[model samples]
Target chain A: MLPLCISHGDLVKLFVIALLATTALAVASLFVGVSEISFFALLSGESNEKMLLVLGESRIPRTAALILAGAGMAVAGTIMQLLSRNRFVEPSTAGTVESASLGMLAVLLLAPDLPVMMKMLVAALFALAGTALFLGILRRVPLRSPVLVPLVGLMLGGVINACTTFFAYRYDLMQAMGAWTSGDFSAVLRGRYEVLWLALALTAAAYFAADRFTVAGMGKDFSTNLGLDYRKVVALGLLIVSMVTASVVVTAGILPFIGLIVPNLVSMAMGDRLRHTLPWVALSGAVLVLLCDTIGRVINAPYEIPVGSMLGIIGSIFFLSMLLRRRSRAA
Target chain B: MIEFSGVTKVYGSTTVVDDVTAQLPKGGITSIIGPNGAGKSTLLSMIARLIPCDRGTVLVDGLDVARTSGETLARRLSILRQDNHMTARLTVHDLVAFGRYPYSRGRITADDQAHIGRALGYLGLNDLGDRFLDELSGGQRQRAFVAMVLCQDTDYMLFDEPLNNLDIRHAVGMMKLLGNAARDFGKTVVVVLHDVNFASCYSNHIIVMRDGKLFLQGSPREIIRSETLEQTYGCPFEVQELGGNRIAVYYT
Candidate 1:
């Protein structure tokens, strides 16, 4: 008998359970906002128009944005991890988000009348440049220790963040920049969040190229030996990562740690074959953000906390625990 | 046949592999034995196209490796290097199945499954196929990597220091497996080995390298002698006949 870690049947069963859980959380998230939209009121055909308007204009879009942004950022993180061959590095740590914000600032200051899609494109370009810079620095650093990669990434992120902040303060756009950097689903009405669908499309693209990403993660030699164009795949992966991150950041602001934590959590349960684990990573990411958003809504009750703050608090704890756990294991 | 003509690799100011030109024979185990920094691994990598040569070219079955498409060359040749560190967690079965990626492109067919099974069985990993690579011992992991290379099923296979971390018994077993694969499949096996004794005992042909150059190439009997070994390694050495094989003992 093969010494299986988890059999095919078990994997399918687990996926089904995760799917059901995600559906339940998504449904529950649609009802937990400042405006009370009763599920039974819509079902029983009383005040149905008002409730439907609430659902369509606010609740549904919010829920969809949450799912798309969550899943997209998580998959983007996975791609970054694979491309950098470092688990702890993500967009938030590797200066991608800061660069995207810089692009958004550039667009807003230079051409405030541009369409949302144009803004996202500009942000994605900046993000691509930033991620490339991060990778360039990573190549020079001796990767004798794995933890050093993320440390360098964080330092790079700090530098970019400083530049962004200085500009935001100089132009007196700090308030607007603040709104773009902190995630909030309360303002996600119809047409405001459709750009996140592009993120979803990019995430789907990631699924199709999952195997190549896995091979690339093994190293350049492994990919070349397996007949894969390592440089081409890496470029495609970076493009996917940049676009997804820009879409999420443009639509719902920066969702921190969703990319860093979700993939790592899923890889712990399911192995790192992206084909098998990507869907779960997407689902789990959606579930995490949905849960956090719901909690942020309920805990403040009519006032509401931004999802970014909630995730920041939770994600930092998880990040610290992961670092400690890895250190202990190494010891 | 694998041919290297005036192949050279340079890093910064150092000439790592200095104009190496040699033809490795087909259908047998040819071992490259050299001391540290002697460019054995670099030469093997050049032949496999893992690294481009600063000058000249490598031809595999008359196809220039530098000009051939990666997919076409991968079907014909495969190479595994030392220190296969991976951030992603993979099972032995999954890792071996990747050997079929050149043909299947991530979609596994029945024929690919058969090849995977055969490679796993050849490496005595049938029962351990489902085990994660990190859960396995160093020797088991080495065998798993070898199994992956075998599953590639290329005409020419290159391994750079395959016995880096294995114990004596496993090292011997690994050499025997390479020998068997060469004989059974009629594949060309080129290995960079640090142990001269293993090369003398198991290899049909041996290439000696010294100071980034090919010093000698011949049958094991000619290359494993005391004078040739001492010249290549720049150390005192004694040669002995054991079981119809000339073994080099350098213990002072």
Candidate 2:
């Protein structure tokens, strides 16, 4: 036998290192926004209320939102990959993110005064419906190659995005809707971003069922043979992905490739066992998004580039390299 | 005992396995042998609920495979299919440990651990237990899967083409091991095999399938005759008694 080389202690040590890094980045994020907080002035009790207010209300909430959004989306991506039996798929690929944005648009158009919680619910329901439609289409397509499933998902997402955009343009709500669809942390005030804790709750639920998800990832026959209700597990997985997507979309819009990139990175280091690798996925996700959002804030100083656009650039390059690696490995 | 009643599988206009109704005997190694498109694998799959039959039912120990709760049925029956593809970087030990998921739900108890150990030992895979499945040779990988099915510890075990990549020695070892598992444990083993002579040697009962139908089923001695062999294969086959075993010679 292999003698259990990577012990539990090693994993604990790895987690501790990741945790310390994320904490440092979060601390740095609190200090880097548009407002300049003079620590020396505050310590001398000069009574700069504006710096304290910005630090308390804006930066703290933005940092927390970034961590929650990043971790939740990354965990969601891992679950989506497992349920679909494909590595290239994510919440965005499944059309769930666009569907959630569509739901947000519908609520904004119809009941503009709806509470934040209600908006989240509406968007989550739409996300669930959208993911169901994507999965239904996926079922019909022959899964002969590893690349086909993700391609179908991207096409499904594209169709949904097109429909949503068309409606937004016609109603002249495109400007307002566009802000909610692009991921940026600038507007994340304390009261505005608390809804993302629900995404964290969804993360917990996924963790509880992590082993089942791991088994389910091995394809239907294997999971069914292991006595898993494959359909039910998959449905639960979709629901989790939809809620996490909806929560992030409502709070920070879509942070494009954190989910896709985070899980793959974690898997490269930790292997594919969902239970063991999920914490690493969440940690890496939180770290990656936090670091990127901080850089986005500082890159323009007073003005900010959207975190989603930043991730788009980083995520695509990472994704392309992964694809190349797989091709070369296969060859 | 597994009872297949009027089992049929149709794809588009053609039937893959058409109306196979028979009882697989309990507590012995039964081999289903046939040509490439003879529905042998399909029929075995239907019995294990791996494939839903189009027009009939499969009963294992009086519980209909299609309608029974998967958890309950899983405890009684287990199946190993031919193509075992996975994306995980699992060692042989890790893969075998998952065989206990039906019972332990990923929480391997001491008893489950014991079963895993025994299965590895039974397959003589203990030495290779720590190696990743991708690192192992094809024959070793094949044995690892067989070990997993055995570790499932179900009373009724079914395998679809378990000897695909095995060399001659391992193939013979596999047949004898399966035969011993059946005889020693009072287990029912249903295997689909392409080699007729191996079937004649190890199988307590032989079933020949041709063109989606059951062509012949009997003891090795009765089913190993030249007439039955020729009819099943659609070619001339010579049967000879060698070392007190019935052997079928079909090659040029």
lDDT of 2 by residue, B1-252 (tens): 888889999999989898988998899999999888999999998998988999999999999999999898878998988988876656798788888989999898999999999999988999998677777888899999899889999999999999989999999989988989898998999999988888999899999999999988999999999998888888999999999899888788
Find the candidate with the highest DockQ and give its number.
Answer: 1
Please give the lDDT score at residue B31 for candidate 2. Answer: 95
Question: What lDDT score is found at residue A258 in candidate 2?
Answer: 87
lDDT (Cα, 0-100) at B28 in candidate 2: 94
lDDT, candidate 2, at B215: 86
Write one digit per residue (lDDT tens) for candidate 1, span A52-143. 88989999999999999999999999999999988898899898998998999999899999999999999999999999999999888677
Cα lDDT tens digits for candidate 1, B1-252: 998889999999999999999988998899999889999988888888999999988999999999999999989999999988878888899999999999999899999999999999988899998788888998889889999999999999999989977888888888998998899889899999988999999898999888899899999988888889888888999999988988788887
* Candidate 2 clashes between residue pairs 3 or more apart in a chain or in different chains: none
Two-chain DockQ for each candidate model: 0.79, 0.57
Separately for all candidates shown, the number of backbone clashes (residues 3 or more apart, or on different chains) is: 0, 0
